[model samples]
Target: MRQLIFFGWNFIFNADVSPLRHIPDTKRRHLVLQALGLMWAVSFGIALGSYTVLAISVLGHAVLIAAAAVTVATYTAAASKPHLFMSGLGRSRDGEHD
Candidate 1:
């Protein structure tokens, strides 16, 4: 059980061995990560009873908005300076390793 838990954790959190590694385009890979983050954040908020059929509370809305803002900011940063996010990946614009 412990091994299974550890594997799950790594599979979700470990970038070095992530499926993203196969995506040679750095921008595309980071974009995918950003999308995943946004989805996770929104899903987490929903799981915590943030959203309801009737209405959403101010705090819940604020949390979701903040998540969206962060996603946009990170996307902008990744687009302008992808090198900051490409530490161990070493992939260049032309899909060549540096």
Candidate 2:
């Protein structure tokens, strides 16, 4: 809990707060990967014209279904990964850091 507040203050006050200073490099990489996955999910959801339509309609529809599945899976996985959560965000994981 304290760490979250500290992270935000550091962002405002300290220029030396290296982005990777708080988390391990490995975890930082995972965080970037997860963030990119989330962005991709948004793009896919936006570009795919009709959401209610099932993927069985056309051959290319399978791509939409696959993308949706990936997005859901990434969301699920992110829920378990604490580094993926922004510290200053209202949704702090409490003891759920992983």
Candidate 3:
């Protein structure tokens, strides 16, 4: 248990696998945006399930679902192609630093 806790803490604070280091610059932004979209989708599903099971506040559940949807949409769009609004947000493809 102690070792597991230490490993978790280290992983959280000092991650060894940096996406920038592991993934090529061309695909790094796409990968990050895709991951963000996936996370939002997961959150949406979890919130829906929780509301169904716990019968919690409908307003809160709706808000969570809406937020997740919007976030996922934005991330998906950003991942699909480069846009003026999201300029300077992702890694450069012209051998430029982010």
Candidate 4:
């Protein structure tokens, strides 16, 4: 069971970042980068649709744009400056807690 868990984790979280070691902060940066890209895409789609097929009201479109902007900005900052997401618990980004 433990091995299964470890394998799953490595497959999902450590697959790309393996060569860099399991730095949690670095992993977080990767995740945030992905999220930033996703949100940016979503925002683009919504903005485009708002101009054509989507029937969303002006206020709804504005709110969606605002949320997307916030998400992109937050994740971009986190991914760009990894230290901001550090655990700072005197331990590596591994599961061990010191």
Q: How close is candidate 2 to the true structure, as a TM-score?
A: 0.26
lDDT of every predicted structure (CA atoms): 0.80, 0.68, 0.70, 0.72
Give per-residue CA lDDT, model 3, range 1-98, as digits (tens).
99988877555433243333444554665567578669989999998998787765776799899999999988887788657455686678788864
Shift in Å, residue 45, candidate 4: 0.4
Rank list by TM-score: 1, 3, 4, 2
Per-residue alpha-carbon lDDT of candidate 4 for residues 16-86, written as tens digits (9 for 90 to 100): 64433454576676876678669989999998987765555766788999999999988998889877667
Cα lDDT, model 2, residue 9: 75
Name the candidate, 1 or 2, with the larger TM-score value: 1
Of the two candidates 2 and 4, the one with more favorable lDDT, higher being better, is 4
Best by lDDT: 1
- Clashes in candidate 3: how many? 0
Per-residue lDDT for 84 in model 3?
A: 44
Q: List pairs with backbone clashes in candidate 3.
A: none
Better-scoring candidate (TM-score), 1 or 4: 1
Where does the lowest 10-residue lDDT sum fall in candidate 3?
12-21
TM-score of each: 0.40, 0.26, 0.32, 0.30
